[model samples]
Target: MGYALTFEGLRDLAEGAAVLGTGGGGDPYIGRLLVEQQLKAGRTVTIIDAAELPDDALVIPSAMMGAPTVFIEKLPSGAGNIAALRALEAHLGRTAAATMPIECGGLNSMMPLLLGAQLGLPVVDADGMGRAFPELQMETFAVYGVSGSPMAIASDHGDTGIINATDNRRMEWLARAMTIQMGGASYISDYPMDAATVRRTAVPGTLTLARRLGAALRQARAEHADPFQALAAALSGTLYTHGLVLFRGKVTDVDRKTVDGFARGHVTLADLADPRDQLEITFQNEHLVARRNGRVVAIVPDLICTLNSETGTPVTTEALSYGQRLTVFAISTPDLMRTPDALDCFGPTAFGLADPYTPVEHLTAVP
Candidate 1:
């Protein structure tokens, strides 16, 4: 089924996307504001299930590529993504039938929505990554053999470039360099594919899922219920079934820096009661690994999300600071993302961790 996104729905979607962001994917608040600008201008965004897209329809994924830390300080001009989309369309010599998110996390999740509203194109209810990943080549679209180039990138100043790389990895390398040159952030349109390809490779219903998750959190707060428990119950009916609180504490230390066009760093949290009990999360733009007192509690390919302890609002990696009370939540990734090929792209080892890939369910099991 297809539906039109309302202002209220966008709020829920952004909130949910932040949770799914796993502490990366730029900032959802910024993304939401971008979309809100379009809506306020009388533009509307229509979301349709991937199944509703004709097999021949061309789908382009839109996103911002760069260090989230820099993105916050250097806001987008809002013209970059549209310019990138236009440049890509010119390169392909065909208008896109629809636009979708390369990843369903944080700011990227709303990129397609903004594009769709601005261009009056339907937004697909799917995305390449169910959650956020650091690098462009880490998407399922690439994992399942979709080429990321010929892709187009645009800067806030209207500067644009196109890359036709030999492979997705090379595409990512090239784009990363260009993004850094664009002042640490650039808008991009990549992995232009037909609807059938998107349907087969992309994670389905993620936009809907995000909206549901946000609604669940909002409703839980309204009812004076535990938001985490509400979130878990919400996940029970979705493809991502297991949601658990891995740790609850206050951020004690943060060692983050932007390098190679990524926010690469780690944050340490101390238990509210036992200061000796600690949790450390390492990241490259997104939360990749969570360690509790020197032991691995949750790892990549799984969703490790940091949220406000009382409000259940997601806190991005760039926003993590000392003395903030936070809850580290972990959710299982879909089986598609757990496949060997998927792991090869975003596994713990892929992030240079010695810990082997283990399902969150198994890692947090009670003995």
Candidate 2:
């Protein structure tokens, strides 16, 4: 069946989405706040389990593209996001029966939730990538053979356009330029497909997982418990099963910049107990790779996330800074993302990392 997200339940959902966002996906604070406001005004957001989607139902997977840094400065013009989906519907010659998050990390997760509420549509209870990835082509939708063409890109200024390309990568390239022109951030709805395809492409239960993760954190806080332990336990059996504390330290250095409309940077963490044993985390919006004392401990396709050691709050790439205390956690990528085909598309080589791809399950020995 389906369920509605209540205002009271938002804390768990937001915190969980941040953990799943893997240190990217932009912060979920704005998204959560927006949803809370809507619910406070008596609006309802319904989420249907992926399996509940009818075989022929139309589902549009979407995301907000551009630097997370820019999104903060440029709040979306609500109509522009809905207009993009409407534009996609126009191109497809049909109305969408539902919407799905392209990736369930940070603000992007909130876009679909908020949009669904605005459009009075039910959101599928799953997402393309269980966690967030940096690019549009990094989704299970593409890996499972769905084309993201005949897409729609819209800006907050009532400007919308349809893009029909031969592949997903080209669409991203075209849409990216448009986002830059639209003032560095825009809403994009692509990979529109049917429920059958959605069941195959979507990472099941992620929305619910995000909620539970958030709830656990909230409970931990109430009891003055270790939120990190709560988070690890929450992720133990999902597709993101292999998760463990990789390092606990104080941030001593940060190098960041906006490159090609993406926030790219690395942070250095010095162990609180043994200052000389440092951990280096490199990221392109999302945390992508990590090394501990010169040994590669984690890499792309696996999550490398940092939480405030004291409060269990997530600290994304754009927010990393010096003297901040942190606990770094590594969570395995979904099984759908670990295959040979999926790996070639988003693995180390694809990200320009010199080392060959190695599983975090193997690298850090989470088992």
lDDT of each: 0.93, 0.86
Q: Could you say which candidate leads in lDDT?
A: 1
Candidate 1: where is the Cα deviation over 4 Å? none
Compute the lDDT for candidate 1.
0.93
lDDT of 1 at 133: 95
For residues 47-73, write the lDDT of model 1, one tens digit per residue: 998888889999999999988888678
TM-score of each: 0.99, 0.97
Identify the candidate with maximal TM-score. 1
Backbone steric clashes in candidate 1, count: 0
RMSD of 2: 1.4
